[model samples]
Target: MIHPILDDNAADALVALLAVREAGGVPLVGDSRWSTQYWSAVSSHAKAECVGGDKAWASFSSGSSGAPRVILRSASSWQVSFAAVTDLLALTADDVVYVPAPLASSLTLFSVAHSRSVGASILLPSRPSSSAEHLTRATVVHTTPQSLRAIVEVIEGGAPHSMRVALVGGDHLDHALRRRCAALGIRVIGYYGAAELSFVAVDDDGLGLRPFPGVQTRIVGGELWARSAYLASGYLEDGGGPFRVDGEGWGTVGDRAENDASGRLMLRGRIDGAILTSSATVIPDEVEAALRSIDGIDDAAVFGLPNERTGALVAALVQFSPGSSRPSTARLREQAAARLPLTHIPRRWFWTEDMPRTSTGKAARSQIRLCALEKKARRLD
Candidate 1:
């Protein structure tokens, strides 16, 4: 019988504990103001399920990737991942780790696990905006790229914070954001993973690349496949998805990837959203990233359009930076081409005050694509 932890004290923590318990190990639940009452409920459930040799289980809220599915992770899996992160960051017991993301997030839980494994002190921000304040006394800061952007904005606005190591994840880190962090004398380490899997790759340096250890990655037919000890066994309900391994035991997340001659992995985009053009394939993420780097563009979403000749043509919908003047279409197209190949250059552009975003703060590419296509159809009509 699967006992789901309802205690709110970092629901993800409860999920992790559940996984540990299922693996026949004892797990500890920590008290947090956000989910104190919830933790008590889960603690009671754990007691009811207690058997002589049964393991303790923890539950945590996995953000937005899948439906609310609880992951059953072994205690060894947590320990191994924590140890790997500690070694990657050179974290010590004396270091002060600051976590700005919600405790329920896998990223924050990983930080907490790393701290517990090393006897380090962890400081969680009371609110998202208070992260800069917490960073003042923090040696190591773990946060999402979005939160890190906010923190850097605060710092640039005269907030006082000294950071030794900055771990950036949750979303892809753009080149523009990385350069801003570098200017602050802060070393940014980019790691890639999802709630379904632990961190599979991390880049400790500023080389714009991610590498993996204790993990095996291969690109099959342009899709990136991986096998690692950190991956969860399977989803709770569906019990099947991309996590399924082949005979070789490698699993894929359906992300298309390209590797440089130096063997560094560069994510092209999700295969689900790939646009096929007559001349080549178009990955929306690559084009969107390029447009976002252009001056005066605040955000961008690139998608495909039906074309008589090209099968599909690229289009971009963008939000301009606040108070920045918009560039001419020709100028914007030229700028995009300078950073991308001709095929990658967006053939159409639509300017908007803002683009819709998911609750997790990622651009709603599907919605934006629909809007762009509708606008084009209306014009033709």
Candidate 2:
């Protein structure tokens, strides 16, 4: 039996999850706000593919690179990590965790389970926009940077809050966001992982990402691979996907990374997202990170467009900070050149007030590229 989560009622969702666990039925958590056609396709596919008594539950991938898929995993896979993450976060029954993200998100679902495992209460808002009322009651927040930024904006507007620590994931945490959290007196703990790979590495302080507890990570051919019991079993219908598992029980989602001087994992980006232009490869995450570090730039999404001379040309969709005017192309180029290589510099540019984001709050580069091709986005160059 596949249970679909259509509402945002935290109590109902938790009760359903517990019932499914007791009944030994697979739960397919879904968002009702999704298109009916999309939900129908997913539910039908899940019903046909989701078999096996051991399959505990299913959730969608981040889909930042492409369309999301349904992933199935056992209960122990997540139950084991609950203890690890709970201990890492120093969570206790006295804590009240707030998660504003939708239930379809694995990150939010995991946080709910983790909180319940430690006997901690949860404060899940009916709508993400209605989270301000519960903010003052929450001791810990499990959120993405996008959601956390909104919380910061709310706090800046004179709303009272009692959040002490936040477990931020799903996207990169910039220094500006960190500063805002610091001003609010909230300790930000950023982590790097995937839906399929679970917890691979974690950044405790401002230091860097080390291997997550019970997980061993290694760089293999520029991709980070890990061996951990927290990994999901596999996708429901996997023909071609980034997820890979080796004979030695090591798995990787094709994320490129290297070890820094401190022996911590330094993520470059996903290998599949590398852009091929003029016989050179450009990692969009590296370029976007560079662009975001520049003053007056709020966020960025980098991609490649088809070019006649070069195989493809590097392009970028930039979101400027509030109160900052869009800079000239030459000025933008000059700033990019200081931080990026010639091939990495974007030849095409576009600007939007708000950058497109995946459901999990990741920069939707593919969607940005599609908008550029369709002439829906305002092109600057």
Candidate 3:
């Protein structure tokens, strides 16, 4: 089977995907938005053996943890969950599912597959629009939090929202965003998942995520491990980084989480995304969450900046809404100090008009750090 190089063309990509699936060929999909380094990783996975005797989909990791790599997902891995996705979204032939992310991305790719399996019409990625007319027949919207944020504002203060279900993924759904979506009558459900692990847990009630049905999750060494039918095949150039499968067939993606008393999974952050300072190991997501909680700040990214003393310094890059007055760094440090340990409080601060994010809305940490460092990010102390 000839593998197709999918790019910005959705119709061509869809046709190519259909051809590959019909021919039982695992189409290797790479995001055109990715750096050449990302493509190199996908090239490495082209050598991996297609484990099952069925059609499969080869995708690259989101690199939110660290460096991106290729992952081979069997057709059954998605096909087995088709009905679940359909039922979860309450999709029908009359329903039109809208996903504006690129077809190359796993979120949009799986969404494209899900809509087709359920016989639902799809609105593929195109010129960005917030017009209510475009969302007229949109019953279900599968998108990232970044994209959804842009969309909800378009629904007006009390618009007759046509969208019913909002299937969000690719990043953590903030608390305020969840409430805002609910206020608009859009039931937003976010899934915590990875390319290597299709669907691990889902948060529907704005509390926390629970292991998906038929998915068994356990906290191992402060990291989340799972055994599910939808798990992906082994990586091609897996240097044994975070992709590990125990002898019992449980695989973890290096995500750290704690289990609450009621057994709901509380995500701390990724084990790979932590910053080791002189006094404490700071999780950027935790600090970023705190930053987002602050007034006037719209989005934030926290990363470790190289420092001669602490080996690394906690740095924050922030984005605020237009017309909002910028908060002083001293004020920020004071606010963060109340909620975080001294070590967790940012030692430096940078501001960007918008966050550095990938096509799927996940933070591009490396790019973000580069952007801030280029600006000579201000130091707090």
Best by TM-score: 2
lDDT by residue (tens digit), candidate 3, 301-325: 8898889988898988888787988
Predict model 2's lDDT versus the native: 0.85
Q: Higher TM-score: candidate 2 or 3?
A: 2
Worst 10 residues of 3 by lDDT: 43-52
Which tens-of-lDDT digit does each residue in 1-381 have in candidate 2? 666655556568767876886788877777756788988888887777646777887888888888888888888889998877887678999999998887778887788778888999988776665356788899899888888888998998899998889898888887778889889999888889899988888887878889988999999899999999999988888597889999999999999999999898899999999999987999999999999988899889999899999989999999998899889889999999999889899999999998888768888888889999898999885
C-alpha lDDT (0 to 100) for residue 23 of candidate 1: 65
Question: lDDT for each of the candidates?
Answer: 0.67, 0.85, 0.78
All models, RMSD in angstroms: 6.4, 1.8, 2.7
Which regions in candidate 2 have their CA more than 4 angstroms from the true location? Answer: 7-18
Q: Report how far off residue 104 is in candidate 3 (Å).
A: 1.5
**Leading candidate by lDDT:** 2
Whole-model lDDT for model 3 versus the true structure? 0.78
Off by over 4 Å in 3: 1-4, 35-55, 127-131, 157-161, 238-241, 373-381
Could you tally the backbone clashes for each prediction?
Answer: 21, 0, 0
Q: Is candidate 1 or candidate 3 better by TM-score?
A: 3
Give the range of the ten consecutive residues with the poorest summed lDDT in model 2.
1-10
Q: Answer with 1 or 3, whichever has the higher lDDT.
A: 3
